[model samples]
Target: MRKPTSEKNQSEIAYEVLRQKLLNREFAPGARIRYGPLGDEIGMSATPVREAIGRLASEGLIELVPQLGAVVKRPTLRDTTELYEMREAIEPYAAAKASQLISARQLKSLQSTIDTMKKLHDAMTAGKKQGQDIAVRFDKSDLKFHQTIMNAVNNQRMLTVIGDFHLLTEIIGAARHSYSIEVLEMTIADHTAIFEGLTSRDPEMTRKAMTVHIQNSRELTLSRLQDECPQ
Candidate 1:
């Protein structure tokens, strides 16, 4: 497993692992998350497990079932729609504002971001990607790349709010089972396009790219949900 990003507490590591499992669809939606099994699988213990799951329950990623204990939350079509709608509204604006002030150094970081994703993509094909073990790091890189831009947008409140959106997307992405080789390739390509727009410092193009990317993401996400739990 990729080392958890936060190092302060076992509960924190447990949280990241559980969250990733949920996002990656390693555990299906509505799947019971036994405390012992979760902690044991993550090489942790019950204490951290409880702490972690407790936090997730409050975050709406997990639910407390009276009879079955905690299970992954089943995101409704409404929830998915609302989450993507939130992204649609804020991410594009962040992209546009961020483009205006993005530095050359930051742009270079974005390029590196693309390079790493390419490596992960290659690793997946070769069966060497380490799956969730390494994917979380890649996800963090993606998060930071965009976060760097949001920071530049000079909107602290927006940044804070969008961070929550990122968490929600991360959960959805992690739990999404329909994700596969080709879909990820397309996603990486979309990232490339967004980076290209970022590099050019074209606010209009950045906004456009961001909007299209988020919209496409919404479609793909819904498609994945259907594959996982056909109605």
Candidate 2:
């Protein structure tokens, strides 16, 4: 059996686990997060679960409502727009800088992530995998791919900023479209271009590729949001 967490570690442990569930879309946008049941499910008490909920609330992943207690926050159009705007401003530049400075080890890590995404894409296209399962796994690999590039940048502040944004995007749940074969293939192609630019040490090419990828991602996110949360 697994060891139980101490009183001090319980809250932090609960927070991390719940945060990951949100990122994994296991809770999903607009899902209710009841402290009691969730605490039971996670083998923790309501006190720690409530503390965890408060932390996620501060992160904008969960909102505390009058009667509802805690619910996942669905991103509005403005929320999605502002998010991609920050991403557009930050990530492409990071990619460019990474291309110039990325070490061989970072490149290998990135390639491995990309390869995992490709396999997930193939499994998705073959109709051998369920949508949610494959999508969740693919999302993890996709995040790793971007994070590898961000790690290559060697800027602590940038990494933390973009890391928060990535979590926000995961919470937004717009990447749901990636469950489809078309979007999965498109994403793979975009990652391929970014990888090629990085491999060749071409900053301009890397920036352009990342820019295009982010633009495409933004459009897809907006389209999904429009369909789900129309005003």
Predicted model with the maximum lDDT: 2
TM-score versus the correct structure, for each prediction:
0.74, 0.90
State the lDDT at 178 in candidate 1: 34
lDDT tens per residue, model 2, 1-231: 998678668899898899788768788777899999888988888999998889889877789989889988878888888899999999999999999899999999888988898888888778888888887888898889999999999999999889888888877763363468887888889999999999999999999999999899889888888867635
**Full-model lDDT for every candidate:** 0.78, 0.86
RMSD of each: 5.4, 2.6
Clash counts for all predictions: 8, 0
lDDT tens digits by residue: candidate 1, 6-122? 434888889888876664557767789899977778887788888888998987778999989988877776778889998898899889888889888888888887788788778
Query: For model 2, what is the alpha-carbon lDDT of residue 91?
Result: 97
